[model samples]
Target: MGGYLPETIVTNDDFTKMVDTSDAWIIERTGIRQRHKVAPGQRTSDLAVEAARVALAAAGRTPEDVDMVIVATTTPDMPFPSTASIVQQKLGTRPCAAFDVQAVCSGFVYALTVADGFVARGIARCVLVIGAEAMSQLLDYTDRGTCILFGDGAGAVVLEPVEGEGTSADRGILGFDLQCDGSKMDLLYVDGGVFEDSNRIGKIRMQGNQVFKHAVHKISEAAENAVIKSNLSMADVDWFIPHQANQRILNGVADKLGLDRDKVISTVAMHANTSAASIPLAWYIGVQDGRVKPGDLVLIEALGGGLTWGAAAIRL
Candidate 1:
């Protein structure tokens, strides 16, 4: 796993200067101290390429060796050619199956789930899975409740098929569950889309209290289903990596599962909520710090814009 955070630092103190918020008020509510932002003219692909290069190198594989590239991002460079294509070209990889998956924040897991299907069926050999987001670009800086909770960053992981006897002991994705409840879309979303507005771009609008009301129950249930599908119990999970939406949400899910709080990997304090990038970014931190190791049973989960939520079990 690999991760990248832009150079520009936007701290809670910075928000006080631009919005009707203070450092103490922000920290007391979200547990976020600071976040990174991309420079002007730096596209989403730039972050994706940076993270992908490092991940490919760490995995000891060349771009030419990859069979597919799946980028999970809500903020793509364009609506036409997927950012995955740009990432493939910049990495000097051959023309292969490349595309994007946008389940909002649940994207990385969705992309990983899709890639695992291809590898399991012998459709691809090595796949590059990336969750890159410039969520700051989508926020209304004046909206402290939303703007203060996002940052710009990217994370990538290289997944290859590992033969197994069809058990929870498998090395790759053992099991996964994907779901969406569009009825609750108003809880969190952007105000515009391709056809909704002539501007074609819009700032994010979130009903914090409403979203919070629904998150814990759906997220906890998804986690439980994934673990049971993998034929394992919560006690068997060595690590808990939840989408870095909020510290409160992370703790809520852990408590629901009766899992140790220390077992959870979190980067929300420094990275804030990088949306789809949060899970992989948190996982990369664990890998680097020696908390996450090979053969560890890991539980991954997220809740995103579509009111989409999912979970997957992996033996990494």
Candidate 2:
């Protein structure tokens, strides 16, 4: 369900030395125990490869059988070669179309939508979609407000075509809704980029309160949109695999939607906001732990930088 975190754990104390923050402060605001950071020299592609391999094995498929690779990462190894292409080569996949999707935290769902379209159109048999991030690379470790909110990790899923009556009961993707508002881009974004900074990525800047306010509303709306698109009522959802941002945000969204708290799968306490990697990682963990099962109706929702948000309804 999820890729392994590096053995080393970085505590808030470790960050206290690097940033102006304390463990008590971080714990009080965000329920993060610790987070995993890739060693220097590790790249997003590396994480994607491992996650993709695990997902492929989980789905009982070989690399050669995969017909597509979609990587969702704002942090890529390089700008020249797409991370998905790098993953494709690493997995030894042949004759497959590979690319990247960038929707910040919602990138996984966006990438999944692309893969779903390919499968539905009979263009691909099996697609490997990965959400990998090295947010540590983009973090301003000295900034207390944002530095403690991010971590590095990756998660993946294997999508395969299935024949069924065209209905919500089909054992695959049923519905999805994606949205973006550039006017709110300043709510959470990096300050510098290509044209201005010699193509070097910049440090992340976030208005925590502003982002928090919109996230709760938009995520709930996306969740409801997905459920309604599937022609299902909220009561029919078996689980909600929400983006693991903060416990408060998750709880707020669940409460707003009147969703059962027990049905929400969360990994924020352990993952510490892995951006695009959150939902897939949570889904993987839930399924691997027997919390999610075949025939379960799973709803996923996410919001992040770029003010992008989306949701997907899938019948497991």
Candidate 3:
């Protein structure tokens, strides 16, 4: 029915001793004042379960009502036990298909798109989709540029079947587009991975300038494409929820799309970039603060490490 984000959080200043960057510098570049990091012993599934509980409660449904669990994250607790399965077990849901979707930061949107199709195609009645991350484990605190840009958090949404007249005014997902550029993989990626690197965790590495450039350009195009696919004009969009990466990237996309600054929903100023968790977290905050409401046309877009980018147009 809607979205949910954790209330607990941590500020950038809290990381001052853990890294070399200052709060002023982080805020100036990323617009992030704080973020929610999982406790040392906290697992990704723990965050997912909490968020799923809130979302299911909001939808007024029990776990048994859910037909699928889709978790979007790059930082799964283990390489073997899918985070979705762990969430399924924790929620005590009836047997249901469960899996994880990995597309880096654009993961949530990608997962949401998949869930939307599942419902629309009559494969599922109710779906619980979660975007959870524990990026703190991947951070190389010594690298200020990358270290300062990420945090840990989770957000979830409940998507139920809704029939529409097959038009842009449809209440559920109206339009969606997903794209990937393998050529840009080197721009933002970890140095190692389980399958290829002997199961060793990799250090986060990024070329901020290049990623920023492509992010602004691709995100703008993806947003426009989604709008067009929905058969609606940009002016019809009431809220633009872009990926919470850098403040500059958000600004550039907003400017290029000709959307009013105020029309953009920004939690990055506080949440930093939770990667997959960013959009849903922003959506949850917007709803909680009364910025998002029923009947509003929302445009969601994201760009991340597979060089993956995606967009969705939804009428709430």
Candidate 4:
């Protein structure tokens, strides 16, 4: 696993001058003390390539060893020549399948699930799954509601096939439950796109209350389905690494699942919400801090724009 956070640190206290918010209010509401931002000229793929390098190194492999690349991100370097392809070029990987998955915040898990299937089918042996975003580019800094909730960061994991009997007892990517309800996509979205008059990326907009309501239920439902699919239950899960959307959503899901607070891997306090980058970023932190380790039963859940929500189980 690997993660990369930009060097520019923006604290809630710093926002006092830029927006109508206080340190206490931000913390009490979102549990985010600070967030990172990319400097001028840095693109999403820039952060992504750095993250991919670290992930490949941690796995004790080189870019040439990569058989496929899948990037999960909402903010791509551009709309064409997929971010995955750009990463491949920077990483110097050989020609192989490369693409991007844009499931918003649930992207990493979605990409991980896809890689798992590819390796399982013997189509690829070593696949790099990355969740990266330069979300600061899309934030309206004056909009306190959305600006305070996002940060710039990237996380990656290299998935390799571990031959098994093809059962729930597998060592990697044990089970998955993914779902999306697009009927109400308006609750959280950006205000600009290709057809928009603004050449720049659009700022984020969100209905906090509506998103909160769906978050608790969808997150819990995904986690429950994932655990069941793994032939296990909440009691069997050793860790819950959820998207770092908000402290309240994380806590609510934990309470609903009857899981201990300590067992949850949360990075929102420091990393804020890096959209799709949240999961692997949190997972990397958990591993480094010794909270998650080999043979651990890890459950990851996320709810993102597109009203997408899902869960993935892995026996590390």
- Tell how far residue 146 is off in model 2, in angstroms: 0.5
lDDT per residue as tens, model 4, 140-200: 9898998899999999999998868776666998889999999979999988998886566
**Which residue pairs come into collision in candidate 4?**
295-316
Report the poorest 10 consecutive residues by lDDT, candidate 2: 1-10
lDDT of 3 by residue, 1-316 (tens): 3343445676787779888778898888888888766776788888888888888888899899989999999999898789999999999999999999999999999999999889988999989999999898888888988887887888899998876888887798898889999999999999887666786678899999889888888988888998899999999999998889988888899999999999999988777888998899889888889999988999999999979999999999
For model 2, residues 51-169, the per-residue Cα lDDT tens digits are 88898888899899998999999898888589999989888998779999999999999999999999999998999999999888899877889889888899999999888999989
Name every residue pair that clashes in candidate 2: 1-284
State, as a TM-score between 0 and 1, how close model 2 is to the true structure: 0.97
- TM-score against truth, every candidate: 0.98, 0.97, 0.96, 0.98
Considering summed lDDT, which 10 consecutive residues are worst modelled in model 1?
192-201
Between candidates 3 and 4, the one scoring higher on TM-score is 4
User: How close to the true structure is residue 50 of candidate 3, measured as C-alpha lDDT?
Assistant: 86
lDDT of 4 at 27: 93
Off by over 4 Å in 2: 199-201
1 against 2, candidate with superior lDDT: 1
Give the TM-score comparing model 1 with the true structure, all chains together. Answer: 0.98
Give the lowest summed-lDDT range of ten residues in model 4. 161-170
Candidate 3, residue 279: Cα displacement in angstroms equals 0.6
